[model samples]
Target: MTNSSAKTRAPLSRPIIAGVVTALVGFTSSFAVVLTGLAAVGATPGQAASGLLALSLTMGIACIVLATRYRMPITVAWSTPGAALLAATGLVEGGWPAAVGAFLVVAALILLTALVPQIGALIASIPASIAQAMLAGVLLPLCLAPVTGLALNPWGVAPVAITWLIFARLAPRWAVPFAFVAATVVVIIGVVTSGKTVDPALLIPQLEWTAPTFTLGAVIGIALPLFVVTMASQNVPGIAIMRSYGYEVPWRPAMLVTGLGTAAGAAAGGHAINLAAISAALAAAPEADPDPRRRWVAGLSTGISYVLLGGCAAASAALVLLAPPAVIPAVAGIALFAAFGSSVQQAIDDPGERIPAVVTLLVAASGVAVLGISAAFWAIVAGLLVRGVLHLGRR
Candidate 1:
């Protein structure tokens, strides 16, 4: 690269760096969590890798098409956040089969929401505070994983996590990048050399695909939560990021895309495919290109990367096991802390419902699972119930 070209590109480097980092996180930390969720439900390694492959393909194609036509830096992602919701699906009575059925149900919800604005409105009608609370609550337990993960290699991850928290506190822009770098090095030195490696074969994908089975356990338990999670975690955040950047992508088709993609992923041994927010922000921002008209090219570029990876299932498996477990938790926790704080603050800002809102936030952060529903979802339900009862008694 010539000095002049390097200098020219430097101005746009921030957004590019952010975009690349976000995508990396989507694959490494976020992908690892998804695998963990899959295993919690007894999905074999083959199914987990298949799920990742399917999501990448679906997201890649959709993102390329939408962003190109729209002439924006739009991004599409498999529902990484939906891992929280997938917890119940993984533990259902029929396990993977039931989970697939549940995925279809969620897909139906996505289709319905896309076709019906009233449904979107109903989803939107949930107070921003509650949504924030729900988000924070869902993510709260996940944040704790890094801390415990650090215990696995305190000397390695402890320093990385500490450095990340400090950097996140002082330098918002550099936090993730710096922490990721530090963690990667530590994993190599601390975890990898310590002989924590799984058999390379155990981590590779099995190309053999299985057909999905419909089941009652999946419909009642897995499907319901998957729908809620995809909505709460993926769609909600995705729309917010788009709105934040002044894009007006229609929600209906987007929701349909998410639902359908998830169904495909389920059939391929994956769970919860939906839009992405954090990485999408990096792509949609002005830094993707100086002339917004050309931004589609960047989306096209990302899509190409996705396509290559999706076709190579073995690569996906290797990527999943590429990083140390501790690294995933630290990256995720540090990344979401600010958003989590904001949610907590928003949930309690209303003077009338301040006390109850606090209750909502606490319930969500508690990570308590009841009736197979996540704490985040239940927190919203519980808060709404409390808020409703209080409102009604006054009436």
Candidate 2:
């Protein structure tokens, strides 16, 4: 490649930097889940760092390769759902090793799903409209949560949320990061002026590493749950996210790489890693780059950012503290405003798929709970299942 072309291709564009920052922006939402997963699995602080390392390295490399190879604006991330599972069930551990055993099982299941054309095809069969609806539904809570947070002390949250909404509504690209900064300043003022309480006199730095141990029960219960979350919450969203941006890639290789990333993270006390849906959209959007070919550089830039962030947990924590809770939802809502609206609009624009898509959107938005599975998985499943049954009945 020529020097000029290489430079142009490098992920240094203003949009790319914004995208990377946005991708990393999500670190606030699920970090507790990751740490809880680590603690539940008996990892020391050092082990968590190592897990972060493994997770970042694997995801970083994979995103670069996948984006470059596919020539698409693709982005990857850890399964927020998997991390949630870790937070909830990570307690059932043989420590970090147990989590790894769970990771292995999850990886295996994903491989099976990938190899089995039926499964992948079935997922693909989901109407783009329905898929979009599901995504929009999943994001609804986050959008509203900030508003609800207003009840708390409105001073910290209310101002931020309201201002963010206003700014974001008017000027999304400029408004999002601005909202985050504004909200953080509010929270800082709250903490300083009001004297909010804190736990642990100092942030804990417990770091240790132990080989993973596998227990059948842990694998079945703990690991399987994490796997499901990774696939449902992380991968499904990832594919939809990529497609949302108009990139086409075979799902199998993507699944494999994500599975491997998760396993590698598990080795370090992290949970399932995979293609990022929400955070990635920030980086991979048409807005991130007017030219899609140059977008891979953005993905690569994100990976490099991960390396830096992953290096120091303390630093990560400090950065996390940089933003107030209100900042997260307000800014995230702002950033996602376009994508969500566009996806929903796209899904409903087609009259043939409108009904099924509407059903999917409603089902996803309902937040109903029958099984332990979160609403995300069920939205897709029920939407497709309903569509299938209707088609057969019509025949």
Candidate 3:
């Protein structure tokens, strides 16, 4: 009895440590992207901080609830791809409030997907190649930031790029987080050199709520594309990853929890939260614990850590706000390199899909807005149209 008790307690610490690391890595690696996305869509610094705080709290709560209730290592995260999509989409009609409205629309769509099976089926029917092509196109411009920043502000961007390169070759998983640290150092040095001081008051987290206003352009341009990317890139892949680890995720419950969390956060400027894809392994893998049954503790611990991290959202946002122009964007860009490569590979994997994929990529990279709709929506339309034309009667 003593041996069994000791054995059980011993493994608990591993999962707990794994959970903390997951939260740290996941938050640090991509929070820059979240801030960049929110600012791009016209959010003020206060509102952007609120968005980050809301996302952290909501997803953390979702993870705790899901993991505890289901007894599985089901982790939750903000949609990084969806945030990238917002960064690419930029400001839509009616500015930040409309973007907030679009966020709410995405939340509703996610809820609908859980309640109505057909909605998810329709999204699933979209060709993987086309969907990925659109994603690749959206990522292209943002991914170019590192190069552009290097040319524009080498002093600030070089340290970040070099740190990322070194770590990417050695410790691939921690590369982005390290780059962020380097960027933060650069920001601090610049502040000191310029005799500028950061206001302590700005570092305190506060929620800034925006009343949402719906518009046709924001709905089609931001909401639809965001929903598609979150589903295709985050939620679906997350489920598959967990299944590969021999855990059957409860889909409806997961969707409902994420959907409701998203809705709760939308007014506070949060974009979307969903199942974790890339970071799910940190909590669910064998390294988290030899016993699969105990891995859920890691997920629970991750949620708690994230909730605590929410307190730092204002400070994180303040750092980005103070970051010398290209520094933050460069970090955001390097953090996305892995995602960009995967998207491009999957976008043009099929011989027949190459032309349509290229077309989509070009259109999305062009950053064109027609009839107030952003390039992302048009990229999808253009890809599907070209694909349909080429395959006409081929079947």
Candidate 4:
């Protein structure tokens, strides 16, 4: 609190601020997707809260550990695409327990990818453009939530949108974070004026465990697809984000930690945790700190923030529960617009990969479910098939 200490820490404030912004963006943006996914798998509200807490803690630890060990801004996040896949897939034979089992299976598969180099190689072999396309496809519909909010609550969404637009022009780096602040202000005013309050108990940490049940249907319908989507859409892109910023990341240790983290989360109704994509960019970007070597502080700060947020899981969950249905999604969509734009551009960047990438995008965007499998899994399959056929023709 003293001036001298404050002056000393001033130089490091940018990365710290960036890290906090990244944590807020990641947690606020995709948590609804996680809740919806857990609900679809038959988790009760309490179970869902516990799941969110578990995931937050695991991912926070992963980000902190990996970033510190490697001296790189390695971020971790729950697999948003995998969560969407869960939302689309619905409940399996044994309800929540079966879903838990499926989650464990998916975690084990992720671990296998670390232990068995061939599986990781196989995933890496997929054209990066196609993977980007699939991620874009998965994110496209959610990004429209702000538009949906505009129709449903223009008064609430307009100011947020205008703020983002203004900042994006004047201070591009802070656009999303500024918009988030604007929206948070609006929400607080509405809550206070409306005289609506949440129970303090919701702010307390609680843990719940489900006895997992392994069923063939759950494994086939949920596990495989979840693994594929989390690996392709989240883990791969997350690594690419770090590399895009010129960081050399070791894949095996990262995968092992995330795999272990996902499994730890599964015991408490969480789905999957993987490397972060968008938030990783925030921490890894040069803007986080002038000295690139010290940018790991951003990841460390993000991890610490996530842990704090996890402690407030109950209150955070309650806020989402009380908000206007469209509000959460709109805010989340706004936070994700930059990420969506990047994915779309990357998806089509390579002319040779364009067709397959487009195919993947279209399939993922379609949201088609066939025989209990989600479109994301099919998108990858379809894109790879198209790519293989094209390769054969060249041969």
> Taking the tens digit of each residue's C-alpha lDDT, what string does model 2 give over 1-395?
78976676534475568546755665543443354355545565556555655666667777777776776656677665454334434344355576667777776777777788775565555566766766666555545655666664466566656765676679654455555566657756756776765444224433334566777656755655455445555677677777878776678888877766666655555566777877777777776776676777677777666655555454334333444545444544444455557667866898867777777767756665344344545666777777787677574
**What lDDT is reached at residue 34 by model 3?**
93
262-331: candidate 1 lDDT, tens digit per residue: 6566666666666777677666777766545555555565665565556545544554456656665666
Question: Better model by lDDT, 1 or 3?
Answer: 3
Instruction: Spell out the clash pairs found in candidate 2.
Output: 41-95, 41-96, 44-208, 45-206, 45-207, 46-207, 76-276, 77-276, 97-212, 97-213
CA lDDT, every model vs. true structure = 0.64, 0.61, 0.94, 0.82
Ranking the candidates on lDDT from highest down gives 3, 4, 1, 2
RMSD of 3: 1.4
Worst 10 contiguous positions by lDDT, candidate 1: 10-19
- Rank list by TM-score: 3, 4, 1, 2
TM of each candidate vs. truth: 0.80, 0.63, 0.98, 0.83
Specify the poorest-scoring 10-residue window by lDDT in model 3: 3-12
Residue pairs with colliding backbones in model 3 are none
Steric clashes per prediction: 5, 10, 0, 0
* Model 2 regions lying over 4 Å from their true place: 1-57, 64-74, 79-106, 113-116, 166-171, 196-253, 267-272, 276-299, 311-343, 352-363, 371-385
